[model samples]
Target: MGNNKSLRDMQAEVDQYISQFKEGYFSPLAMLARLSEELGELSREVNHFYGEKPKKSSEKENTVEEELADMLFVVICFANSLNIDLQKAHDAVMHKFNTRDKDRWTRIGEEGEDENGNN
Candidate 1:
């Protein structure tokens, strides 16, 4: 959560995570499917939030948060298997945008506009 760590560090953490699993309980394809299911759950929350779909009757249930965490867990597990540092990957994309497309998505604060100011 603080900063990028080496692949070795990520690998060690992944090894510890795998230690808790029973042998051959799941496969890569299964993990991907699980990830997809989590994404679908998250999408439902987005739909409800945007009024494109009705909110569930169990409003107290935090399905969205749980789904998001589920998606992240699988994503990190996938990246760990592929020997990718999620933080490093994230930073690389951010750097690319900062260097190459800094102005591609201009916003009011930078555009010298209060065009839609909510004040």
Candidate 2:
């Protein structure tokens, strides 16, 4: 079964998987380091695609999607270790953005739109 799991399901799955291991989850500091490393990998991929840096001939090909998934896996592990529900966290952040930044940016109709209302 793929592509059917929600954020909580994914967290539970990761927790279950890690439960089988003797070591379980890494320490919080170690998890943070792993997250940083994964982020760096993503940044490197982005730099290769959009920045001046070029990938070495010997470097293996990596996609942004793959790196993002890797990062998400680590994030799931972190959240599982801390008993944090990512869905709730996501909702809280969304709420904050919706309320706090609601008027932060200019609305499309505010400045007026093009002939077809395509601003």
**Model 2 weakest 10-residue run by lDDT:** 109-118
lDDT of 2 at 15: 89
> What local lDDT score does residue 54 receive in model 2, on the 0 to 100 scale?
96
Off by over 4 Å in 2: 112-119
In model 1, how large is the Cα lDDT of residue 8? 51
* Cand. 2 Cα-lDDT: 0.92
In terms of lDDT, the poorest run of 10 residues in model 1 is: 110-119
lDDT of 1 by residue, 1-119 (tens): 23685545655666587768776224678878878888887888777776577876976555667878677767777777666777788889989999888666756565654435443
| Every model's TM-score | 0.66, 0.87
lDDT of 2 at 90: 91
What are the per-residue Cα lDDT tens digits for candidate 2 across 1-119?
Answer: 38888898899889889999999999999999999999999999999999999999999999999999999999999998898999899999999999988767667656655444565
